[model samples]
Target: MPFSLSIIAEAWPTFEAGLITTAIFCSVASVLGLVLAVPIALAQFSRSWPWRVSAKVLVEIVRDTPFLVQVFVIYFVFPATGIPMSSTVAGILALTIHGAVYFSESIRGAILSVPKGQVDAARAAGMSYPLTMRRIVFPQMMGYVLPPIGNQIVGLIKDSAVLSIISVPELSMAFQNVLGTTFAAPEAFVAVAVLYWLLTSAVTLVMSRLEQLTPTHRSTQEMTSLLAKADR
Candidate 1:
């Protein structure tokens, strides 16, 4: 049969369910990734060699290996070690760990981009490390980090499709189910593609808005200038 919107309409429920599932799980995973990444990123600066080395190893392994293999190991292999998890949970865990390593690197780079002098001044002025990071480093780092974080969020959503291999009812799996039933390859795929585009575009727009709202270099400079005068 020729391509038809009717086939897509008939499959809209499955597509909608899959889209919702994708949105929910990916949102959880992304937030967790950012939270976990901060500690891992900071660990790279730790004076302890073991902490630094371990964090570096985690980042290298995840960044170097294929994500598909990671998912397979989590879903298929872990059960044999008595770590059984539902596919949804497994998918979330995989995405969380994957995004965390990449996001940590982005955060680490952003932290490095903030001039070391500011940190030194913070230390000289009796500021503790946490205080320095909070007042001196984090505000400035946001401006540099948001763009890459946005890219990672988009990549995370796309990567969620891979979870369909484990029967995690996501958009790609929705497409598969619909295609299996109706065999409307063109129509099913076109609809899924449009949905994915819309989802990623919305994330990009939000990130852009956040980038605008975040403090600029001038503001950070002013803060540092005031701090310097106080130290004098």
Candidate 2:
């Protein structure tokens, strides 16, 4: 048989299901990973030696190793150690850990980019540490971080394909299944690639919009006003 779009049309259902799974895994992992990154990033600046050391070691280990190796260890090794997890759980966990460490570094860099003078000023104005972070540091940090964070999200989607090794039923696995039956490697792979591109493209579009709308100055103005009031 010759190359045809019919093969893609027939396999649409499988592809669609796989795309949904991929979306869910990436979506959940992205949110959890970024949320988790905040504390990990903050921990690096903790006054306690143990907190700083632990966070540093974790960031190093996760960032240095291959994500594929991490996925394998989570899926195959942890179960034997009495921490059993389903494939779905394992896949999401691996993605989350991978994303968190990378996102933490980006966050740490963003935090550093915020001028120390601003923080000192906030403190001089009687803002508590938490209050300063909430109203001063975090707002300014968001603009610097958003671009890198957007890139990380795009990378995370691509990384989710590795989950197929553990039978997570994501896009790659779906295409693999279709290929197994149809043996149309070209059509199966092309379709999967296109879907991945589409998914990542959509995420990029949203991130771009967010970057444009980032209220860095407005937030600073509002927080500065609040801080001024507190000073008074």
Candidate 3:
């Protein structure tokens, strides 16, 4: 029942490399997810039934399936289609697509929560779809979406551990190697757990700060007033 941090010290280089990989993987994949998600979320509200249905199906399929399966399919099965990818590329694709769907749903929910009258007002005033979204919907929706989006970002960081399943050499895989050579599972696992906690904590901290920096909902009211004036 003996425990020692010396095991971690012994393989510090491997652990450090893994930590760096995890950081880059998480940040890049999360940003890619968010960027792709916004458009897909908007598509869910599309006037065309086909676009709306297709977007909804994509979102649901990704959300419903387990991430482990998604990664396995991307890494192992996908190459059968004749396009081979490195483990890293496959892992990144899985993370991006999976996270994007979740982010899209968060966005779609926030968009739906906006008052119907605001949307109508924008339409009646001859505002284009994109402009209405910008001037009317987004202003109010930002507050509602921020909290969930923050949660999703945290999920993205933690889920990067799954990248190890595909042998992408992430933090978890690095520690698994440590466990193999040292037989010190306790210390290796503890180190990775602490590192993940630190990364996620930083995400929550930054998100909270951003939420505070967000202006009050005065913009929504201003948008309403502008719509009212235009109607006259």
Candidate 4:
């Protein structure tokens, strides 16, 4: 079948709105996920058993289940229990909560990757626990966390399509809507896929630049080695 450019052009407005909504959901979820992740990660690594166990349980429960089930629980089950949320709100909430679990694991791993000597050195310098974590550990952890965090963000962008099942009007929903009206399935889906590719590609590019700008341990070690040699 011959492909017609006019179909894409005509569907642009609907797709644009869907893209906007998807972006908004992702932005809000990313920020909220980060906020939720930091505390859970810290708790997971806590000296206290209760805190660690609680955090671990939460993470496991979310990770082991399918996201679709989680969405249903949030949208349908919650409403049956007296908490009603709009489709968009439910989609964002489910995505944020689910993403938080995965992001928290990344953070915990990053924190663990920090050298043991660094923590001991900070403590020896009389730095309080919070101060040490804030200044020394967190900075180092970022270098480890960023790459995986970028991957999660890309995953979340793609996963947003699942929200269409709940009637969230995301990019996939827009494509489906256009297909329903025009019966141009191929054109609509191709356009939507391109939009998704653009969004994810933009995220990957920005994150790659950020990773380059952020100093890693390898660079720090090289700098330190150079300084030591200069003293000879």
Count of clashes, each model: 0, 0, 0, 0
Model 4 vs truth, CA RMSD: 3.0
Deviation (Å) of 140 in candidate 1: 0.4
lDDT of 3 by residue, 113-200 (tens): 8877888989999998889999888877787777898899889877888888778888888889998999898898898888888888
Over 4 Å off, model 2:
218-232
The better-scoring model by lDDT among 2 and 3 is: 2
Give the Å error, residue 232, model 2: 39
Ranking by TM-score: 1, 4, 2, 3
Q: Where does candidate 3 clash, by residue pair? A: none
Indicate the worst ten consecutive residues by lDDT in candidate 4: 214-223
TM per candidate comes to 0.92, 0.91, 0.89, 0.91
Indicate the TM-score of model 1.
Answer: 0.92
Clashes of 4: 0
- Deviation in Å, model 4, residue 184 alpha carbon: 1.9
What's the C-alpha lDDT at position 191 in model 1? 94
Candidate 4 per-residue lDDT over residues 82-117, each given as its tens digit: 887889889999999988988998999999888778
Q: Which runs in model 1 stand beyond 4 Å of their true positions? A: 219-232
Error of 4 at 22 (Å): 0.4
Best model per TM-score: 1
Best-to-worst order by lDDT is 1, 2, 4, 3
- Top-lDDT candidate index: 1
TM-score of 3: 0.89
- Candidate lDDT values, in order: 0.93, 0.92, 0.86, 0.90
